[model samples]
Target: MMTLSNLTSPFPIFHFIGIPGLEAVHVWISIPFCCLYAIALSGNSMILFVIITEQSLHEPMYYFLSMLSATDLGLIISTMSTTLVVLWFNLREISLDGCIVQMFFLHGFTVIETGILVAMAFDRYVAICDPLRYNTILTNARILQIIFVILLRMIVLLVPTLLLLKRLSFCKTNILSHSYCYHPDVLKLACSDTKPNSFWGLTGLILTSGIDIPCIIISYIMIIRSVLSIASRTEQHKAFSTCVSHIAAVAIFYIPLVSLSLVHRFGQSSPKLVQTMMANIYLILPPVLNPVIYSLKTKQLRGALLKLLLSKNLPMSS
Candidate 1:
């Protein structure tokens, strides 16, 4: 008697062909992605460390930035570490359990990242729109509790989703096209019926991304409205300037993700390289640009960075 579990025991394998034209293009493409990944990791790590050690940055805005930086760092690591291993060593075989674990972390971190972004948006909204209440609204104790609740909810929701995905009998072909075991890619390989998976997966994606994006949009909308109401031109400019970094960061994050989704659903025939590039952009670009955007746009952060740099160069100057 053949059992369903045993039938799916032959874990799937994946491979990338080094086609001549594509290979040449990939070499050039991979360099920048590698650089971006390094920068993202290093920059986010620096932000996290600075925020933790610097008492001056203990305020609500920098506290949220620290949390966001940590999440961004985790996001890049969750995606790129496996990708790097596969790309460099050409290791393609993934056990069923290994694949499931990867999917869980990938999905989990993505959800957490969105939650952190939402938190940051709310922080900004409180800061600019309700300055009098900012202290009460975003106190340390309250912010910590909110982050804890958000993380708890994200984990509790995502674990069941991944477990449900794991329960599906993967009797179909096991060759995953993408570098990671993304939910959509994994669902495509399930031998059992996937209507439930498809429905739930899409629903979850829609609900999560939908909720976070709208919250961000609404925050910025209110911020803009508040900016307009300010009578002083200089104050209005200062208020708007504070949000420029966040806007740049959000656009870089969402645009690539949305584009990748569109290409996946609509342009199935798009070249594999193109798909890979877009996927890498989502994974790499946001983190790479996030710290840069925030640091460069905020005079305080830029001053801090410059001071740190000057301190480092003081011995040489002497």
Candidate 2:
């Protein structure tokens, strides 16, 4: 007697592809990956530590930056956990539950980061366009509320998507592109009706990026209007300089994301390596570069970092 479980292995295990065709050089690939992960972990951790310890860094702007760093850390840990294991050790098999867990965190963190960036854009809008009301508007209580709402939004949209996934039986090929468990990658392997899963996935994406991208754009437009209204060029430059880091952050985060989506949607014939590497970039680049960007671009963070580093060395030198 043949059973469905016997044929498909209910809760089928999935396998990972290490760079598609370049399987032999996963060792070389992991070298830079390990380096990037090290920098991302240490850098974001340092940013959070500095922000927490230094009383001067407790303002609303730095608080938002701390949230960004924390999101980046979650993203890095979620995706990189499987990546390094596959690249360095050649272990590629993952249980269905494990893959689903990875998918949840990866998608959740990505959405959270977008929300945090939008929040930061609003933070800048308040700082520049309504300077007098900045602190009053972005109070500690309000910031906590904002964070809670974002997490709630993530849960509200994502939980049903995962639940829909659980109801589907994955009986197709269990190979996934990239080293991580991506939503679309997992969805296609389901051998059951997936319209509900797809709809929820799209709903989650639209609610996050569809709304967020516009809010960020509108916030900056207002910011630009306020900056140009200033009489002195120096003041205008000063105001614009404050926004450079944020603009850079937005660009780095969005560009790779858009590219990866386009590749998946339109470039179906493209090499798996292209899609795989793009996914890697979308996950890894922001974490590795955001700390460097903030540390170098934000004057107060830079000074605090230098002071902390110098203080540590001073005692050691003696």
lDDT of 2 by residue, 57-174 (tens): 9999999999999999999999887999999999999988898789889989988999999999999999999999998999999999999999999989877887787788877368
Please tell me which predicted candidate would have the highest TM-score against the true structure: 2
**What's the residue-level lDDT of 20 in candidate 2?**
84
What TM-score quantifies how close candidate 1 is to the native fold? Answer: 0.89
Q: Which pairs clash in model 1?
A: none
Q: Could you tell me which residue pairs clash in candidate 2?
A: none
Model 1 lDDT at residue 109: 75
Model 2 TM-score on a 0 to 1 scale: 0.96
TM-score of each: 0.89, 0.96
